[model samples]
Target chain A: MQLTDYEKQMLGGENGPAVARAMDLLVRYGEALGAERLVETRNVAGAFNASTPSIRSMAEDGFDRVYSELNLDSDDVVDIPHMAVPTCQLITGIDIENHALQGADPGLVDMQKDGERFFGQRGINMMCTCTPYQVGNVPVRGEHLAWMESSAVIYANSVLGARTNVEGKESTGAAGLTGRIPYWGLHLPENRLADRLIDVQVPVEDMAGWGVLGYFTGLQVEEAQPALNGISATPTLWELKHFGAAAASSGGVEIYHIPGVTPEAPTLEAAFGGNPMPDPIVFGERERVATWERLQSAEDRSVDFIMLGCPHNSIEQMSRVAELLEGRKVHADVALWVHTPRALAEVSKRSGYTDIIREAGGVVMSDTCPAISRRLPKGVRVIATDSAKQAHYLPAIAGVDGWFGSLEHCIDAAITGKWRGGP
Target chain B: MPDGQSTSKIVMRGRGVVPGKARAEALVTRQTISGWGGINEREGSVIELRHELRGQSFAGKVLVFPGAKGSSGWSAYFHMCRLNGTAPAAMIFTRMTTKMALGAVVTRVPAITDLDGDPFEMIETGDLVEVDADEGIVTITKHET
Candidate 1:
């Protein structure tokens, strides 16, 4: 672990006590990861699982405690995505319903308070929600960066070709404070090249298809980065967003590529950086079905809940759901809710998208999702979701039957209040 | 300690997340735990439905898994375990995710990742194990052995 003159000076307390402390942590993180040098990050995003009200209250408390304990001041705030002050008006009603903190899990609320207070005291803006790309922190195609969220890191690395490491929370906060990260792993241009080629001949449409494709790729490569040879045009940032989110949700990877979308791979050969292409895995219709089959549990019983928006739902996704249930109503017996960032929720409200969903009896909430709040609604016997990542873990954590499938299946369950298995 | 502990030297490889030492019973999970609401905040036990080791305590166990599944707040769940006095003795992961890594660092637990052998298979739910993260080795002694 070598440090530059500036880094050494900072470590020596030359850059004020606050910065010096942050730098110390970053240096330790860098050493832990075996990084040789440090690099500058242009922008940073905030958080992925937002907290609920009870959780928010707890966060505020935690902030106050950490504030007094550390005697920290306001000048140390970091300019990042989710931490920014609420730029958009927020609408909160039923969105926090199905989460782990339904009636306010006291411990969870306290933890949330701890997080909120920590960031608040540190002068970090607490804009609640995931999908920081909607607000800001949009890394240009091919920029070097460091971010915390799995979806964000994968999207930046795979679609934008921006280099990054899936560094965790503390490191992200530490990096944001100093605006520097270790220049190793994906940050290096040479490390971004594709080691495996994933050829997908199956139809790539619906968001679920892309998500399934990601699962397939992740399962095949395990943790290695792969280049997708056959695919439709480079997906929009939104589509790539879901793909990356679902992919990283299921597997451990920082980058993947479509022949044209990623900057590193303007062409197939270019994506390889002129290196030899690894053997290709032909992923066809059978492979898609097999992937789906592999994920299905085949144990279907009436489910009490269904959840969506793992990385938090994008505005467009919310709009689509709103349109689908324009005048219809959700299953009265089953609980159905949508999750969105506070900023996006404001936009949806102004646009009347919130009203449309609300009028249909489906509530939309902002600032927190189920996974973070840890507050599931009362009497949830079984839970089903459109996200494999959610389906994979929710059952184990929530103590219920975790069913998997696409939006249609989830909506059907939401409509009938019964798990009809998969289509 | 039991006399002549049934310890076996099984070489496993995993990318190291944090560098330290930890030893305890092996608690391997193929079913990834949900980031939120998965573990009891106070009890540090698996409460999630369908989890292989549901109702089991993580305390003093050498937790093994593939990687973190969802939520960037994944570290917070483990942090709660630390607060509840049920933190794992150590951890071995086949892959490293930012959430899992943060949990390891925040919890100040020893962890070794990128294992050469499939820990999900080599380790069982209740095998005594010692994780020497400094040497990147997981020594497991099966209960029945």
Candidate 2:
């Protein structure tokens, strides 16, 4: 890969060991992806860190070694003083703030807190979330970013019109330290053109319908760029969030285009980039129902846990949840958890949505979700969630049966502790 | 079981992403494997509930699949496989994607992709596969039943 003089200088160890090591990893990673040259970014939209059992084990080796191995993929221990670009930590392996609520061991909680402190000392914002855009890290249209988290990547690319690939933890770390990424894939405008055209014949009025559409579309065009048409109504931000999250979870779609809805797709012709649109794949109600049926795993109605957010709920979504549970209470047999960004949690608290949720016996959590943390109340036999992404993952990650539905259906399940069929 | 002489070696060519050589039994699947929580890091087993090879362990085998699915966090989980000493002996992706590329890099195994022929049609589970990443050739010796 071609590198600038400054990059070469860094590669030559002129700028110090940490930057040099980070540059080396970036160059190799670019080469691995067949990227020709590195691109510079002025507005780096922060990064999401990946925490695993192996990464957690690095505590014994100390923070320097941990940073070196996890981020730089180097064995050499080097001190990283600060990120070259602004950075924020992503959802971790366990909920550090409320481990007891998740039924986690004390040692696991200590490990998470220690990791947080180490990252915080290095200038990484500790607002761990998949939806960093909700927490004031919003990137503008056409901005270049190095972000991880599948949902965030799709949202940045499709909704925000920012350019970013679904970056891995290592590459994002390198970008945080070097403010550079390989200029290939979704970073290039030519690759962003829609290859598959999807016509939404089904009426997608709610978040669940949009999720089903996205799930169906993603399965149809696996790894291919898709553009949607024939959608009469404009979707809300929350609906788009569900659409992108579900599509990205079920398929390998890094970017998508919704004509007149998402930025860069002002019209169907523009979404196709002057090329002839491919034959449209019809997403009808039958397909949507089938997709929804596939997500349901529970044979019985009993639900032990009800989780509200997957990509971390926005403040608006939290407000809606609060409104739904206003005068109700979560069933004694059900443990209802509402996941959101820490910043949004603060806003929800100020708005009294947190108190309302608390009064209803639901815990409003931040910095983590069951999908990333891989934690749930012990012996949770069945789980209900409004997120298609969460429903697709919880069975495998948490070893529980899943019931996927709308927010109202999930709230109803939380109240009655029973999933009385579909909404 | 058939005699050793009955086993025939078939050589297929592809591009090598990581440089190494290993011969192991193959665990093939057409479904793309999810990166996050898809595999058990400790045991190196496919834990994706609906995956065809659900309970099968990929440890010490050649993992043949259509490439990675879901999150970019895929590399981190596979990286843990390396640290835990439970990674597959080698990997063969039918189609290369960014996530799978990073996974191959972090796993540091003999990995190949963009084959001359479809690897899914050519390889099967239990086949003794030898990967020469340096030469970009995979020698498959089918198990004689």
Candidate 3:
């Protein structure tokens, strides 16, 4: 990899040991990925540290060792005093506030608290959300960033028009220290061009429909950049969130283009970057329904848990849930947990959405989801969720039967403790 | 080391991203492994309930799969596997993506990818495999029953 003079200096330890080590790792990582050069990341949109048992086990070895081993892949411990740019934590192993609710032991919770404090003291924002953009870490169009979360990576590249690859924890951590990343993959302009075209034949009128469309599209164009056409209406931010999250989960889609909807693709021709568009892969009602059915594994109608907010709920989504739960009560046998960002939870509290859901026998939590927490109550054999991403992961992670449905359908399931299975 | 006939070796070549060597039984999965909490770090087993290899342990075997899936935290979990001494001896990926590449690096396992043909088509579970990643060769030794 070709390194600039500044990068060379950093590699030579002119800046500091930590920065030098980070630069060295980035250069090697870039070379391993066939990158020709490194690029300057204008701002660190967010940095998600990996919370694993190995990481927690390294607590005795101290934070520097944990960062070195997990993030830098080195044994030489170095202090990361501060990130060069603004950064935020992603969903950690345990919900710091509701550890008992997630069935976490006291030791695990204390370790999580230590991890939180380590990053917090280093000037990293301890938001602990997958949806950082919703919580004051928004990166604008054309900005270069090193982001680690898959959903956030897809959303940044596809919807926000910002450039980022699906960075691993190591790469993102290195970028946080050095404020740069290798210029390769999705970061390149030519690589961002859409190679596949998708025609939406079904009416994608809501967030669930958008998720289904994204899920199908991801399977159709695995690891390829896709441009969508034939959608008549403009999609909201929440819709795009679901779409990007599902696409990233179902497929290895790092970036996508929607000609009229997204920022980069102002026109079809522009989306293709002067190249000829491939034949459109038609996504109709058949594909949509098939994808929805594939996500549902629950044969029984009874549901023990209804979980929402896989990608972390935005304020609008929270408001909608509150509106749906008004004057209703969750089933006595069911537990409904709504997850959002900490900042958004505070906003919802001020707006009374949190209280409304709590009054209805549902709990609104923050900073973690089922996939990250990897725990559920002992009797949670059957679960229902509105998010396609959650539906895809919960079964694999928690070993629970899942029912995928629209937000309204999920709310109805929460109310009656049964999944009738419809929007 | 078996008392059967001479070991029959079928050698295949690929790009070696990490340089090392290992010999172990193969644990093959056509589906990609989700990174975060996809495997139980302490046990080194596939805990993803929907995965074909769910509940099966990948510890000390050559983990063969299509590639990585899910969060960028994928490498982190695999790294934990290494720290816990429960990671696979080596890995063979049909397609190399950022998540898996980083994972291969962090785990420091003898890893190879971009094979001449599909590794899944040829490799199977219980096959005795030898990976010479430094030489970019994967030798599958089929032990006759």
Candidate 4:
């Protein structure tokens, strides 16, 4: 890989040992991808938090050790410098204030707080949500970003028309320090176009429908860009967010085109960028039903927990949840927790969404989700969630069988403590 | 040394991203493996509910699959597997994505890709295999001719 003069200087240890180590990791990672050069990136989001119990020993050593080893994949224990570019922390493992509710160890929570302070001092914005675009750092069309979190990467590339591959922890860490990522894969213009198309035969009018479509699309084309046709409804940020997150969860899809809906694809013909499109895979009623059924692993109707707002919720979603929950209490046997971005959680507080949900015996949370934290309600053997990404992961990560359905279904389950929703 | 064993050895070539060698039983799967929500790092087992290798630990085996799929947390999970001593002895994957490449690098395992021949067709789980990633070669010793 050809490094610029400034990159060479950094790799040669002119800036500091940390920058040099960061550059070194970039070189190896770039070469592994067969990239010929590195591109400058001013935006980066990554998992820089040391919140997991597995990293307790390293955290005991110091946050620097955690950053050096986990982020840069280095062993040198270099003092982390201020980020060279704009950087933000993605969804962390534990919520700062709700650890007790999630049954997390207090020691781990304290370690996370320390990590945030150390890294935050180094200029990393603690956005603390997977959906950073919803919170504020919205990148414009054609902007290059180095980001981790597959769901966020897919959302940025597909909805926002920003370019980013699904970067790993080490790669994002390196990019945050060096402002460079490999100019390969999705970073290149030629690779972003759809090579195939999918025909949506069923009406995908709601967020749940979009989630099913996204999951089905992923199963049809793993890692391949595909444009969707036959969707009649105009989707809001909420629907597209769920769509992208669900797609990335089921498959490693970084970019997708909705033809008329997304920014890059103004028309079906434009979606392919002049390449010959393959036969359209049919995502009809059967496929949609199958995909929805595939997401639910629970057979027992009794629900123990209902988790919402994966990729974290937008304020509108928060309002809708609060509306459904007004004057109602969650089932005494079940727990209901609503998650949104930390910034939006504050807004929810002022908007009375938090108060409304709390009054109804549900909790409003931020900074983390059960899947990322692996911290479900204690003794949670069965769960239900509106988010397809959460449904796909929570069952596997939290050791609980889960049901996948819409917000109404989840909320109803929260009220009755039963998995009455179905495919 | 188990020298002069009656089994025939065949050496295949590929692009070796990480440099090291390990001889272990092959745990082959045609399906792509997920790293984050798909596996238990401490146990080194594929835990994705419906994955073909569900509940199977790859700790001491040469994990042969079609590279990583699902979450960008791929590398982190594999990295943790290394820390926990539950990582695959070597990784032999067909496709190389940023997730798998970074994962192989951080896990510090012997990893090879871009094979001249189809590894899935030639290798099977429980077969003795030796991965020499430093030289980009895999020697497979089948139990039956």
Compared with the true structure, all predictions reach lDDT values of 0.65, 0.84, 0.84, 0.90
Candidate order by TM-score, decreasing, is 4, 2, 3, 1
The residue-by-residue lDDT of candidate 3 on A178-287, one tens digit each, is 88898888887888999999988878999888888888877788778899998788999889999988888788788999988888889989999989878889887778
**Candidate 3, residue B105: CA error in Å?**
0.4
Choose the strongest candidate by DockQ. 4
Number of the candidate with higher TM-score, 1 or 3: 3
Residue B58 accuracy (lDDT) in model 2: 95
- What share of the reference contacts is kept in model 2? 0.64
Ranking by DockQ: 4, 2, 3, 1
Lowest lDDT 10-mer window, candidate 1 chain A?
A84-93
lDDT of 2 at A157: 95
For candidate 3 chain A, which ten residues in a row score worst on lDDT?
A45-54
Tens digits of lDDT, candidate 2, A1-423? 999999999888887898888898888778767889988764443333434455556766677777777777777889876787777777766665677887776766676777678777777888788888888878889888888888888999999999988878777777878889888888898888889999888789898888888788778888889999988999988888899988998888989998988888999999999999888888886777888898888887899999998889989999999999998999999999999988888899999999999999999998889887777877899999888889888899878899999888999999999997573
Clashes of 3: 1
Error of 3 at A134 (Å): 1.1
Docking class of 3: medium
Best by lDDT: 4
Model 3 — TM-score against the truth? Answer: 0.94
Question: Which of 1 and 4 is the better model by TM-score?
Answer: 4
Error of 4 at A204 (Å): 0.2
lDDT of 1 by residue, B18-133 (tens): 77888788878886654544567566677655467778887888888775654454665676566558788888776554556567766668988777877877888778787888
Clash number for each model: 31, 0, 1, 0
- Which segments of model 1 are wrong by more than 4 Å? A47-102, A105-123, A294-303, A418-423, B1-58, B62-71, B91-103, B110-144
